[model samples]
Target: MSIKLYDLAGIDDRRFSSNCWRTRFALLHKGLPHITVPKLFTSIHKISGDNHRTLPIITDGKTTISDSWAIVNYLEAAYPHKPSLFDKQDSLKSYSEFLQHWSLKAISFPLLQIIIKDIYDRLDPIDKPYFRATREKRFGKTLEDIVKNSEDNVEQFRSGLNPLRVSLKHRNFLSGKKPLYPDYIIAAALMWPRSMSPKQILHEDDTLNTWFKTMLSLYEGIGSKQPKEWVGI
Candidate 1:
């Protein structure tokens, strides 16, 4: 059965959701050509046919699957002939949770302060209100107020990436020789800001930056082809 990827898109049709990007990378790794559906925040429920209102949803034939990790597992089990996201070694599921939490704590949290306003600005007008209300409630401040100090502190935010830098010092990817879920998980996190903001979040010579460039070139440059509102600002 053919696969369908329900992506979360920005106002300009830019797909920027980190979670959705993870699923996209997994789909590419599996060599699955799926239909891409661009959805705004409020439209998620319409696609899933349930109360659940999140993206990275896929409809494979008559089966509907949600969440990036679940989607990855489903594709792996269904398409065992394809390349594995788990590296065909130990299942990265437990490690994936660890990575997800650390990613949110170390990467996404700091990165969010930098990109939060940018994300708000890029949202479709309809999405802006919901995004702002929810995010503001979560952060307890105006988006602009929260991001105003990011410029001076972006350095500290990048420092959170030290572990990634050290990990990739002698490797091209997190999964040793090839990119895997571990790599894709973090790449998706970083790619979100790249797609929205015009700032250089990493040094040009950074190992993670190099690996990220390689990721952009993978899957036929799907990662880089997505339109960025601004870059290198």
Candidate 2:
């Protein structure tokens, strides 16, 4: 079945959020035919309704799934012949899947907030005001308010890193040697920091950096037709 994914494009390369990227990566990983539809964060709520959810939402021909985790679950069940995203019989896979779900949620949101603000700072003055105003109107809060909220949850965001670090250390991939749903999920969140994080942080651990580069290479392989303009890399 053909799937459609909705997301926002043309922000900074850093804002290439992991949630959206994960869904995209999963679709590609399964070798599923899919179409990408870019929408601003405001448009996502407008299209999907008051949940105020953001990109990327996936629509299979028969059903529409929001939330990256839900979409991944649906895809795995729908395409069982593909690589198993979840080893239903394995307790470790189940635990890893559970932790991966929360990790994507906890880490990506706050980190994106920080990254978005950094993007805002780099915009030209006129563009900055417009971007801030647009975000405020869409989110029902001033940009400062949003950033403040994210700052309050910084520790929760940091906690996401530990599980990922452990997962990376334990296996070549987050779940195993081959990329699974969690690998794509975590990689999507990490893509932002991987590209924009200080060289010092990215290079701190040789293993982590090597793993990150492998993920990037995988994304490029799958998203070969991804518009050059859309891909910040």
Candidate 3:
């Protein structure tokens, strides 16, 4: 049976969740056949009952898994014959895990502040209030306030990538030669902004931009198929 992926979506079927994108890229990298079910912020609970309260939940046969890292591990163990997400090495797996957290802290968090309003604008009307309320409560600030003067954050967001930029200077991917789970982690972070906001996150000369373009062309253009409005690239 094909795996069922409950992927988060915004207005016009936009799959913008970086966490979900991690799972999507993993599934593609492993050559696993799967289908995506678009989920609104308010409808995530309906996908996996109350057991899992997140997007990127996957159901394979009788097994159901949530969380991107958990799902990636499950896919690796369940389908050993398929291409490995961690290059069949424990060290790589650990590195991928570290990259996951780093991307969340260094990439996703800052990007969210810059693009939060854009995200809210793209949500379905039904999801807008819920998104606003939950996010405002989480940050202790209204969406408008959170995004206020967000443009100033652009440089901070760019500087955060200096480590990634340096890493890419040595190799085409975070995983080296061939892309791996770690590569997906960062790519998904950038995809969050690419899928919705027109804000220009990467400057023209940034090496990370080149890496991202290569990522978009991978897996037979899977990433390219998404609607993108990244502005000045």
TM-score of each: 0.94, 0.69, 0.97
In model 3, the clashing pairs are none
Task: Judging by TM-score against the true structure, name the best candidate.
Answer: 3
Off-target runs (Cα >4 Å) in candidate 2 are: 12-15, 46-52, 87-93, 101-106, 109-113, 121-163, 194-201, 219-233
Question: Which digits, one per residue and each the tens of the lDDT, describe model 3 over residues 46-161?
Answer: 87679988888999999999999999989999999999999999999999999898888898889889999999999899999998999999999998999897989988889889
RMSD, candidate 2, Å? 5.4
Q: Which ten residues in a row have the lowest lDDT in candidate 3?
A: 224-233
* Candidates, ranked, TM-score: 3, 1, 2
For model 3, what is the C-alpha lDDT against the true structure?
A: 0.90
What's the CA error at residue 27 for candidate 2, in Å? Answer: 1.1
What is the TM-score of candidate 3?
Answer: 0.97
Tell me the number of clashing residue pairs for each predicted model: 1, 3, 0
